[model samples]
Target chain A: MNAKEIIARRVARELKNGDVVNLGIGLPTLIPNFLPSGITIIVQSENGFLGLGPLCDEPNPSLVNAGGEPCGIVAGAAFFDSAMSFALIRGGHVDVSVLGALQVDSLGNLANWMVPGKRVPGMGGAMDLTTGARHVIIAMEHCTKDGSAKILTNCTLPLTCSGKVQTIVTEMALFRINNGLVLEELCPGVSIADVRNCTEADFTVSPNCIATPGELI
Target chain B: MNKCMSLHEVKAVFRDGMTIMCGGFLGVGSPEGLVRELMSNGAKNLTLISNDSAFPDSGIGQLIANKRVTRLIASHIGTNPETGRQMIAKELEVILVPQGTLAERIRCGGAGLGGVLTETGVGTLVEEGKIKLTANSIKYLVELPLRADIALIKAKRADRAGNLVYEKAGRNFNPLMALAADLVIVEVDELVDCGEIDPETVITPGVVIDKIVVSGGY
Candidate 1:
């Protein structure tokens, strides 16, 4: 599998039945395609609705997600104004919110909104989702293209939320952000040393850590 | 009372430096007719609040490109590089608010509340200069109510009385904006009679609306 698919599949494993999930744009948006069989989750778009359908070949302008991409809606879906839409979010009704991060640290700090002296995407709803979701997970590639670690001891970019990330899923491994970054599983053909080489943040391997099977179950 | 008006009449009420709340996500639900009227009126030093600074060629971006807005408060401005350029050049003062908090602040302004306490920005730069109060030993940022001199709204359908129904995701910041301004002007798609729209589906009641302009050019 490709890197994004591996990460999305592993992150999909983190989801369960009856989860109302919010997937951030980019890699997090690929999650629904790889959900384990029999797991169903309602999707929430911060722009207004829950029960988001898949992105379409022919998209409608009136039905775009927060990223302004046209998409479909599913059965039993309801649309609302922004105030009530955010009320559900800040009210902690969302079960899990998966977000992409530029950098996630050992302290669970996520910095993805801005990099100083560069173009910044203002925080749309990342702050509320990180602070209010029952479970918050960070999904991103393991490192930059230059082989620099994105999992760091401390974030160098502006933080979306402080100490809010609970899990980190990457192509190399799945990490549980408990006391610190805990290496919970290694991807196929990836060893502890391989993850260590890429990860700048110090971490401990879980005693029961297992390698991802070549085939997704 | 007849609330319908022409673009020229709407422009007459617009003045320089007015704080205007425009309803839209990324231009999907914006009152482009009203926006065009405002631009043509050439109002200056205006404070504009909305969900986003839409693309440079359309929506609120047109206002910014024309050098009308002085201050802007919104959730995101990433899609509009012109807004960033203006902010960087110190021509525009951009205050970024979290989407939920921005909504609740406007909701508070309309609902007669003084402020809203949320943990949305409790540990970040957004907490700067804001009151952080604790209840039950938990801390929250006290976001003050945000009100505007006028609100520009776009509705899919409306009664002559101004009761509104919005379409799909297009309903996004419009309903909230309808409540949070001194003068609420809606640019609607279809304007029916008072009894035409069902009361139960009226997303925004006519009581708060000051004027209506059925969109001339969609």
Candidate 2:
């Protein structure tokens, strides 16, 4: 599997049965395909609906997701206006929100909304998802394209939310944020040094936390 | 209560520099024909409140592309690069609110509430100028209500009485905008009789609607 697929595959383990999950547009969008068999979760599109299915082969123009992407819905889907839709998210009814992040600090601060000096793409529901979801999981690449660390000691860019991320999933490892980022799991063939070499964030290795994928399930 | 009107009559309701609440998330559920009419109506310096500025070629994107909108209050504008360009150039005043907060603010406006308190964007830049309040040790940003001069909403079905039913996800910000605007103008794909639409499914009651337009071809 590719790096993103590996990251998404591992992130799916963070979910449980009957979870109302909201996946951000990018790497996190790949997670639902990797869920364990017989596990049923209702996916949410921030636009205005629950039970978001896969991308439709022929998508209707008026039925797009929050990212303005065309998507499908399950049979038991429910639709509402944006106000009520977000009430579900902000009311802490969503079980999980898996989002792609640009930067994550040791303190679990997230910076994904915009890069200063670059054209500002508006923050959609990410800030809410980071704040309102019961569990916020950031699923992203371990490093930048040039191979620099994204897990930093402190996020230099503007933060989307401060100290709200609970879990961080990367190609190399999975870190749980409990006061600080705790290195809990490693993907197959990934060593502790591999994560350390790429991460700028100060993280401590868990005493008995070294495990591989499929362990969570 | 004859709420139905011709597209031209709907166009007459718009004036230059009007604040419009357009219901849509990324052009879906947006009042496309009404937006197109607003374009030809030559209403400039418009303020658009919606979920997004959509792609450069569609919905409010056309208005933005034509330089009709001077300010945009929305949750996301990444799908429309033109909006980004204009915002960077300082030609457009863009207020990017979190999606849920934006909805709640609009809801508060229509419901005649003072403001909405939310935990979203509490520690982020969204809190920079806003007043923060704490209750029971929980912090929240108090977002003010956002109301528009007119609301351009698209619905799948509407009775002559102006009761509305929206399509699947096409209903994003429509019902909220309908409630928050001074004049609610709905463009319906199918216009039915007063009793045709079931009461339970009518998302927006006719009492608040001011005008209704038949869905126009783009």
Candidate 3:
């Protein structure tokens, strides 16, 4: 599997059956495809949908996710307006929100919305999803295109949320946020040395840290 | 009383400098027919409040394309290149609000509240000019209410009394816009008598609506 797929598969294992989860745009959107069969999780889109399905084979102009991408609806799907859709989020009714991040710090601060001096697309429900969801997961690549680490001691980009992330799944490793970042597992073919070289932030490796399941890799 | 009107009549209510709140998420629940008519009428320098500017050929995007909008208060405009170009060229003023904060501000306007307190933007650029308040050892930014001169809404069905029911996610900002505007105009696919639609099914009531436009054969 490629890096994005590996990260997505790892994040999929964290999902619980019947969790009302919100998947942020990009890599997190791939998690639904990797979920184990028979586990029913209601996917909520902040653009106003509950029980969201994957991208439809036949695209409908009117049906789309918050990213404006065409998607399908499940059997129990229900639609609402943006106000009530956000109310579901800000009210803490959503269980988990898995999002892609540009940078995640040791303190779990997320910076994904904008980069200074660049054109601002503006934050679209990201701040709310990060703050309101019961569990926030950061799913991203381990490094930037220039081979610089994305996991840092402190984020330099504008923050989407401060110290709100609970877990992180990257192609190289899995991390849990406790008092500080904890290295929980590493992807197959990746050694502790590789993680140490790529990660800029300091993390304590869990005693039982294991390699990712072979099937997932 | 009957609330339905002709498209031309509704178009007459729009002025060049009006602040209009349009309901939709990327054109799904937007009042397309009314928007088209407004574009045709050549209203200029209007302020728009919406969730997003949508794409170039869709929803509020048409207005931004026509250069009718001089200012926009929305959550995102990345999907619309025209909005970005206008902002860059200094032809338009864009105020980006967080999606949830934008919704709550509209809700507060409808509910007659002063403002809402939120921790969504405490340390970011979003908090640059906003008032910060502290309660119970937590700090919150005060997001003020947003009200508009006119609101354009789209609905699935409406009764003669103007009670409305929206279709799926197309319902995004319509109901909230209906409550926050001085005048509410709804464009609907189906129109029935007052008793035809169940009261429990109505999302926006007749009393809040000023005019209803039947989008024939849509």
Candidate 4:
């Protein structure tokens, strides 16, 4: 399957109607394309725009927000100030948040904001979303360029969200946060040995794991 | 004192049409001299990238008032209304990324990290017609790093040798972009003698800084 389709399809399976979601950026942004046609996800941005659409051609400066980034605005995205935007996150108005992580641990600790030994600028809003969102899903690669598995025994970097990730999806496997370790679900041709050799951290294939996508969700 | 230079001299090295990543969330600790230079130079076709467009008659909005920039890649453009008009009429090009991801791209550009992948815009127009890359078993939205040829930064004060410290909101994004740019041009409110500033308070080192242009009394 195409990379985008696989991710969108898999992630869409987790969604239901009226779920307010936040997509971080990158692959997570693509999730909107794969959502079921009937579902309407109320998107919230920390910079104070909600129901945001894709980039479009409009010059209204007042339509912009604090994020200072150009985007195609969706129809009817309620705009507000940072205080109101964060209130939604901190108040738990967000049902789910799909975030990108630099590193994740068996304990579901996420280090998405900074790497160790570098002067970290700041954690913008990940801290708020992690603590506020009902379900936190991590969308990232399985390893770093140095071949270091981001799925670690423990994260060595700063925590953006601690022990909050419910599901972690990669190209090779889909793992759920179970009992403080990632429990694996085998794909059509994938085996426990295949998952073990590919991942740096030790994991167990859930005895109740499903082979096909529809079986679990 | 001796470190002070005219706005023309400051703009000389940081020329027009260059990719400049400016610090300042919104008119907060932005390098005034460098911004004024970019304005007076009348440089066109600029791809100005920052956290937010500055307010009208102030910050990056002043640049917009001068009509200098041609493109912008930012997280928010709300602060400046003029730039928004240019964008709407197709006079300017704007590439909008998520806020946290925008900062991370600059951070990643500074840290030599390849593009980051996330799920922020999944299943929305934000993902419409964009490339989706998957690695390992997970999927990610691939956001490339953004590094400027020149970085114009604002600081509260600098010692003779050029160590910087920023005031409240001025401290926001300036320090981070300083480390990420190839040539970091610092604009300081006050220039003290060498060794005058405490070592611990220094946010940006002199070595990373290429030029220190002093600002007028504000």
Off by over 4 Å in 2: A55-58, A214-217
lDDT of prediction 1:
0.90
Q: How do all the candidates rank in terms of TM-score, highest first? A: 1, 2, 3, 4
TM-score for chain A of every candidate model? 0.96, 0.95, 0.96, 0.86
Q: Relative to the unseen true structure, what is the C-alpha lDDT of residue A149 in candidate 1, on a scale of 0 to 100?
A: 94
TM-score of each: 0.97, 0.97, 0.95, 0.51
lDDT of 3 by residue, A1-217 (tens): 7889998888888988999999988888989889887877999999888988976579876788878788889899988777788889978999999998889999989998776545667788988888789999999999998999999989999988888999999999999989899999988788988998998899999998999888766
Candidate 1's C-alpha runs over 4 A off are: A55-58
> In model 3, what is the error at residue A88, expressed in angstroms?
1.5
lDDT of 3 by residue, B25-74 (tens): 88888888899888888889999999999999988898998889999999
DockQ of 2: 0.85
TM-score of 4: 0.51
Q: List the pairs of residues colliding in candidate 2.
A: none
Question: Which window of 10 residues has the lowest lDDT sum in candidate 4 chain A?
Answer: A114-123
- In the range B1-218, model 2's lDDT, one tens digit per residue, is 78888887767878988899998887788888898889888989899898889889998898988899999999888888989898888999999999999999999999999998889998788999999999889998999999999999999999998999999888988998889988999998999888998899889999989888898631
Instruction: Please give the clash total of every predicted structure, in order.
Output: 0, 0, 2, 46
RMSD of each: 1.5, 1.7, 1.9, 15.9
Candidate 4 residue-wise lDDT, A95-191, digit = tens: 9988878888888778875443333323456765776689988877666768678888888776775677889876557898877665655556767
In candidate 2, what are the lDDT values of residues A109-166, reduced to their tens digit?
9998898658578789999888889999999999999998999989998999999889
Q: Interface RMSD, all models, one decimal each?
A: 1.0, 1.0, 1.4, 12.9
